[model samples]
Target chain A: MSGHGLVLRNICKKFGSTNVIRNLSLNVIPGEFLTLLGPSGCGKSTLLRIIAGLELQDEGSIAIGGREVDGLRPKLRDVAMVFQSYALYPHMSVAKNLAIPLLMRRLCAWQRIPVFGALLPGTASRKSEIIEEVARVAKSIGISHLLDRKPRQLSGGQRQRVAVGRAMVRHPAVFLMDEPLSNLDAKLRVQMRAEIKELHQRLGVTFIYVTHDQVEAMTLSDRVAVMLDGELVQVAPPQEIYANPHDRRVAEFVGSPKINMIDVNVCGGRLAEIGGQVLPSELTIGQGTLTVGIRPEAFHLASSGEPNSISAAVRLVEHMGSDLFLHLDLTGVPDPIIARLPAASGHIAPGNRLHLRIRTEQLLLFSENGQRLKQQASVTPLREYAR
Target chain B: MKHCRLSFRTLGRHGFLAITTAFVIVPFIWMVSLSLKPPEEIFQASFSLLPQSWHATQNYIRAMTASPLPRFMLNGVFICAVIVVFQILICAPIAYALAKLRFPGRHVFFNLVLVSLLIPSQVLALPLFILAYQLGLLNTYAALVFPFVVSPLGIFLFRQFFNTISDDIVHAARLDGMSEFTIVWRIMLPMAVPALIAFSIFSVVGHWNDLFWPLIAVRSQELMPPPLGLMAFKNEDTGIDYGPLMAGSTIVVAPLVLVFLLAQRWFIEGLTSGGIK
Candidate 1:
């Protein structure tokens, strides 16, 4: 089946005086998986609900498959949503849960009665068709053995798969998932994350996934839209969002253990942090104070008296088997800067002094208002100091 | 705490419960005993839970064969069942809207339901009578059932239960293409088995045991529920006819007791599960 593209234009929703979604617009190409990634209360789930037609946008229009669906009901929108709770009907068996959307769609009202439904013309065949499809989806999701059981009898992950299978039953043009894996334990979350990516690949359908977890968004989507306080801050590929984020918020929100932000004074053609020389750079950032964004992995070990290095005492070292996360306290800097180094950088512990140098190419420079700026750097390599 | 011998506190608590249990159960024992006793022993001054001379067979046969007692009981069953079913049908939808849907004046409407609950049925009896008479529903089953078709307490109770259910389930059902009524029936109703049982018990017990409304609503013998029919039976006899009356009372209460015993588990759970308070 050909996937349908979705276009949301000028969507604005207000919960009383507070704007939940403010003039948001985004376009999803056919057969692409796009994730709405944001912190909680960032209106990501609200956006998904608005797209599913479960909630109306106060002032916007939504078009799915090139048709405006502003007034259509959720089922008529040709989109299915898997809710955060999975929302599998707890009373229905897995098989009946899978058959509901098809039953509700294919059969007329007269043909939905319990025993009399079968006697009506075309109902018997349609019911068998529904049953067949339900079985197929159940088997595909590895929940065939669970068809006879109620949702409460199944584990959280199994219920989650059944929810996905229910959505897949109709083969809707677009699939909307609102934090479907947040309830599962960590181990199952990782396993199901791969399965969801595989499902998107297999169906080749437009998928809009909303989540607060950056790891899920980072690993799953073709494009990640970072939202904050009811506005889309940046929309780009996952690697681009991580490597060259549009602004400081996107950089801080995406990466784990957070990117280190140091406010540096660009005084007299040198980059200075806390009145110490970080490096001499010639990129014009309009001279004054500039914030330097550094991912924890950007720092490398250097000699104590390196010209571009800042000397710091190791406050803590966390071993992650392959790498070490060192919480270092630089002189005159209040917040400790974390550096992820190879564990083979031997014998590092708390109270040890080391000089850390910022790599020029990996340097992220943001303006005073937290906007990313140009970086065509000319770096002067450091001179090592004598004891 | 786990392995406990008889402590003074436990003993005292059990003693208090036993005394209270006897106080609650003594009247039921008296009714059954009077049903079984001869008329002489029933009227005698001496008190005993068991009958000395057993006249149970005679009293029961007379009560059954005396005056359309079986038909009165059949009427009770039919009316109570209809009231419960219609109460659920009417109350569930209203409760679903009040509990889940977002709309203007929703809280006002819910507060109105609570207000309606405060106005007792006795206050509405005269107006209900006039309405039923105007509609030509007098002395019919419709008059008996229609007045109770929409119960404010049922709406209030069902709404309280529905609030415990997650909104995501409803949204998912909507996306699954089920209509609001279908969701109420298939999704909300099944999950609300406890509340259904609890409300059904309250409605059935209330309507079945009610003599005042039935006396006011229906004059015909055929339409009379058990309590009203039994009251008629007592009044028609020249004397008290205490034995047959007590036997009939036992029969009238028997079905309700059996039903409560059967659904006793769900009944208690329902009341306490998503409690009103």
Candidate 2:
């Protein structure tokens, strides 16, 4: 089935006096896997709850498939959610838990009686149909053998799959998941992440997944909406968010080991003075202090006398299987500068001097207030020198 | 040396338990002995653990034949069962709302429940009697069952139990198209079996042995519960017969003891765990 698009307009929410969501608007195209990525208590889960009709937004309108659903209850919204705790009915067997939704929606009050329902003419057929559907969904999720078992009898990963299977049975136009994999062990989390991605592709439904994990957002989502303190910072593809971030907070929050910050003085419009050395820049900024952010991988090791290089003492070295991260202590910089390099790029010990080179295009300049500055066209290349 | 100390500790524990067990079981043994003894030996001036002259069959026969004792027991069973079932139906939803739903004056209502728990039921007997009389409900099952159908204790117990359940499950049920009524009865009631069993024991025992309310509100012989019926049997002009009286008491107390024996595991677990939170 083709999935339907979702549109949320000017959603505002408050818990007591604090505004948890501030006029947030989002649009999800049909059959797109969009992840809302944020830290804990950033209101991402609350937003998902609002869309599912579990919580009513204070001031907003939600439309699913072009129909406004402002006052509709969750069941009428045609959207299903998989909770973080896997919220399975503990007293029911797996098959019963999966069949409850269909039973409630399909059967009338007279047809739900235990003995009489079986005796009713069409009730028997509907009952068998529900069982068959439950079994089919269970088999698809590799939980066919667990149909008779209760929720407590399953492992964490198995319970998570049952929760997803329950959501899938409804075949709703939209699927909302709130950290559905946070309870698993590390290895199982990675495995379930891949399975969820595959499930999205198979169903081709509009998926709104909420998570605080950047890696899950990066790997699974077609677009990641980064949130901080209840406001959307940026919404873009994962690579664009990583490589070209609009806000300094987005850049810092998205990357591991964190992007490095260096305070430099801009001289005229084409040069930046850093630690008693002049570096050429293509940016035209006012003559003042600006914060420069550079990724760890942007720095590379150079010969001791290489031009346009900064020399500093190595403070520590962390050796990963595929990469080496060196912490360097420069004379004027307040924090240690970290550089990631290939693991086989020669031995580097602490207390040894190291020279690193950074490309002009790789340097990201931000003002003191954390707004990124655009670079202008270059007139000439600056001379190379070592310090 | 350590092995010797361990055995000594074990012996001491068993000795203490033995003493406590005798303290609790001696009264029941005495009651059974009295029920089996003849009238002449019941007040004998000797310390006897067992009946010297066995009149068990005659005493039981007289107890049943004397004054509609079995009918009184049937009434007791019907009344307690109705009260307990109605209490669960009325209390479970209130408890669920008090624990999960956020509405206006929720805290005030909960505080009122706490305050009601402090007021003894005996203090309200006079007002309840007046209300029953005005409604023309005295001497009927309505008077006997109405005041007890809404038990503050049951509501508090169920609220505490429901609080332990995760809210996500309730939300999940709502999203699955179940209404609040369905969530309370179908979903929560099943998960609260232990608490229900424990509350059942408390409700059944409390109403079964109650003499004050039934004496005040129910005056007809046919409407009297076990305790009042037994009292009526003992105070007959034929004078008090100790053997028959004890036998009747045993008959009245038997059902609750049997129920407790059958469900002691869930009862004990519910009491201990419900108290912890």
How many clashes does each candidate structure show, in the order listed?
0, 1
Off by more than 4 A, model 2: A273-279, A282-285, A376-387, B1-25, B275-277
Winning candidate number (lDDT):
1
Per-residue lDDT tens digits for candidate 1, residues A298-373, read 8898887766666789999999999999998877667998899999999997999998776768878788898987
| Colliding residue pairs in candidate 2 | A308-A385
lDDT string for model 1 (B1-277, tens) is 5335557679889999999999998888889888998888987887787889899999999999988999999999999999999999999999999999999999999999989989988999999999999999999999999999999988988898999999899999999999999999989989999989989999999999998889899999999999999988888861587888899999999999999999999888788775663
Candidate 2 residues A89-157, lDDT tens each?
A: 999999999998898888886787779877877898998999999999999999999999999999999
Q: How close is candidate 2 to the true structure, as a TM-score?
A: 0.94
Candidate 2: chain B TM-score against the reference chain B: 0.93
CAPRI band for model 2? high
> Fnat per model, in the order given?
0.87, 0.76
Q: Flag clash pairs in model 1.
A: none
State the DockQ of every prediction: 0.86, 0.82
Clash count in backbone of candidate 2: 1
